[model samples]
Target: MFEFLLNEEQRKLRDEVRELVAWVPRQLILDMDQDKVTFPKEFLAEAGRRNLMGCRYPRKWGGRGLDWVSTCMVMEEVGVLGYIFACVFGVGAELVCDAIIQHGNDEQKERYVKPLLAGEIFAAECLTEPRGGSDFFGTTSVAEDQGDHFLLNGQKRFIVGAEGADYFLVYARTDPDPKADPRQALTCFIVNRGPGVEVAYLYGLMGCRGGGAGRLVFKDVKVPKANVVGSVGGAYKVFNTMMIPERLGTAAMTIGAAQPAVDVATGYSTRRKAFGQPINQFQGVSFQVAQAVTLLDASRAMIYATARAVDAGEDQNHTRRLISQTKKFVTESCQQAAHHAMQVMGGIGYTNVFPVERIVRDLRLASIWTGTNEVMSMIVAHEWYRAYHQAKTSAPRDFEADALEAESGEKIYE
Candidate 1:
């Protein structure tokens, strides 16, 4: 249907989001960083009006039915706006909306995803307890089946969009199996913030401060039996399934966040004079710009490539391997780009007058959120080992046989 990597329609969608970035006042972005903004409901409503909320979802559910790569493109553009906005949009559409579309039953889909994609209400994913960080399967939350309803208990902290979300996608231990793997011991539920659901604390964050990240305590909260997502003990599957969008989306947005700082630094270097010439004339400053831009471009390429793989319904292992690579490599690379951009600008970059300071604060979270870079490294190494062993055992091929034979004396494994 299309010749280039992005089709005509996808290009237009990117334009739409780019137009949004132009329309939104820069002051709003600054205000969010200062903790003056609570939520971006107005922006969310405008995004829904433009039909940009759920690019990869079905049209019947108020989505455009676009591909995952298109969603990545849009997120990258949205990321240009600010990290909080990009994160709010990504969590609602990619994380929560996609989960409901895949695992929610007919009624649940009609109830949640439809309105969710329309921006009629907000949603939050309740994972990550105080004790467990990346160990999702070790969740301390428990949901007991109470006849027609489930009594949910326990608390989730550091949840983004917790203060404004109307619904929650929660995971809890339904039937704990001590001897069984923790992966299969939990269940997923959709809960509403009603009686017994409390917003315990709002964290004073160093960056990405808006959207009210907080602690949610569920004390004997009642959720209808129909609210369960997927099977009773199928949360592991749902979590694994959602990781693609979660990590990939985060990576794409980080690309956007990384670029603005580079642009700022480059522009500053061109204008800021030192020794009767522009600072950009110096290799010291220019190379930083070059490195930053290279990282940004590389991060973008990997994110969209992995996103296309996701759209193609690639093998789960392969998709996760690429996604982990993108998350780890791209995030760290972007974080470095941000730092370089700041260094290029010197003192002004460290101040709020320029955006590099804010970008440095924001980009730091990219490696920490969705999953830590350490976790991503573990996944990449594990997947690499699996593929390496498989190729050696199942589909062995010696591409360097001549070189190895010619250098036989160097082979000392025996």
Candidate 2:
């Protein structure tokens, strides 16, 4: 909607989501923000009913069998509701559903993926832990191999849908040897809510509440061997594959969440007056609106290109770089755009009467989650260097030789 010219199918999907978002009760959003609700199950159930949950998967699996771009289009429209709605809305389809669709056995898919996309069940991905999510390989949560089953014993914190998820796609260290390679030492398991699984505590968050973010304690939870999504001690592949949609979907949804703030500020300025003229006449307000729109436009381009790249099956490394870059750039840009909206609205924007303040609080988490923007930068730089060196083997001009100092032999090195 920002700038991507959609085909008839894409436009139709967008309209459908717009109607769905319009249908969401405003009180539900407020209640969730105020910590009055644990999970927004109603929203997901409705989206699933419309067959809009995971548009990219096969229709046989309850998806539209659409491409990634179409899915992003859906996310962008859903995002306008707010961050909490956007985050929880995507957990099932983007993160949990994708993993099973890609790696789970046919039985697992039929049992989990079908019901999940059908909105018959809620799902959450347990990646972050008590120690921290950033140090993913530094997982303390262990699942001991117990012949017929694995005994999962540990805790996962900040898990959305912890209170209401029908099951969790948990990543736990499966290898007993401490010296095992971290990448190969882990595994993914679909742990259902039962027995020793407990939602120990629900955190009172600064924002983005009501999706049931909480601490999940698993005490000797017995999981059948068949529940393992991928190979034994092979969660790295699954995690990487899931992140493509994880980051891309978040980036797209955020566009809708952030755009409204800018639009609200723009509309307010047209009527808001300072010194007998509309606030839009002043550079202070108009410039902020101008800047926010520009940033939004820039973000749209990056998200659209990256989504297309993913759909077209471009190079893996290149696509990953684009994903990380889009995730980092779009989030940061949207955050700033919301800030501009707040600044433009001045005092009233700070209060809850206008949605700008809520937008600001909600948008703050976008840059932090889905892997921090800092992590995105690290991945981008790492990939760029690797790609640059790999492509350098082809015959090409050495621009360094053109520098006048090339023959001076004055270049010093450590």
Q: Which candidate is the best by TM-score?
A: 2
Please list the C-alpha lDDT of all candidates, in the order they appear. 0.86, 0.91
lDDT of 2 at 240: 89
Candidates in order, TM-scores: namely 0.95, 0.97
TM-score of 2: 0.97
Show how many residue pairs clash in every candidate, following the order shown. 0, 0
How high is the lDDT of residue 375 in model 2? 95
lDDT string, candidate 1, 278-390, tens digits: 99999999998999888888887788789888888898888889999999999999999999999999988899888889888888889998999999999999999988877
Instruction: Report the lDDT of model 2 for residue 288.
Output: 95
Full-model lDDT, candidate 1 = 0.86
Residue 208 accuracy (lDDT) in model 1:
85
Model 2, span 1-414: residue lDDT tens = 753468888888888888899889989989988988889989889988888898989988888888988888888888999888879878888899999999998899899999888888999999999888788899899999999999999999999899889999999999989999999999999999999999999988878888899999999999999999989988999988988998999999889899999999999999988899999999988999999999998998888899999989999999999999999999999999999999999999999999899889889889988899999999999999999999887747877788877989887797
Which regions of candidate 1 deviate over 4 angstroms?
A: 1-4, 393-414
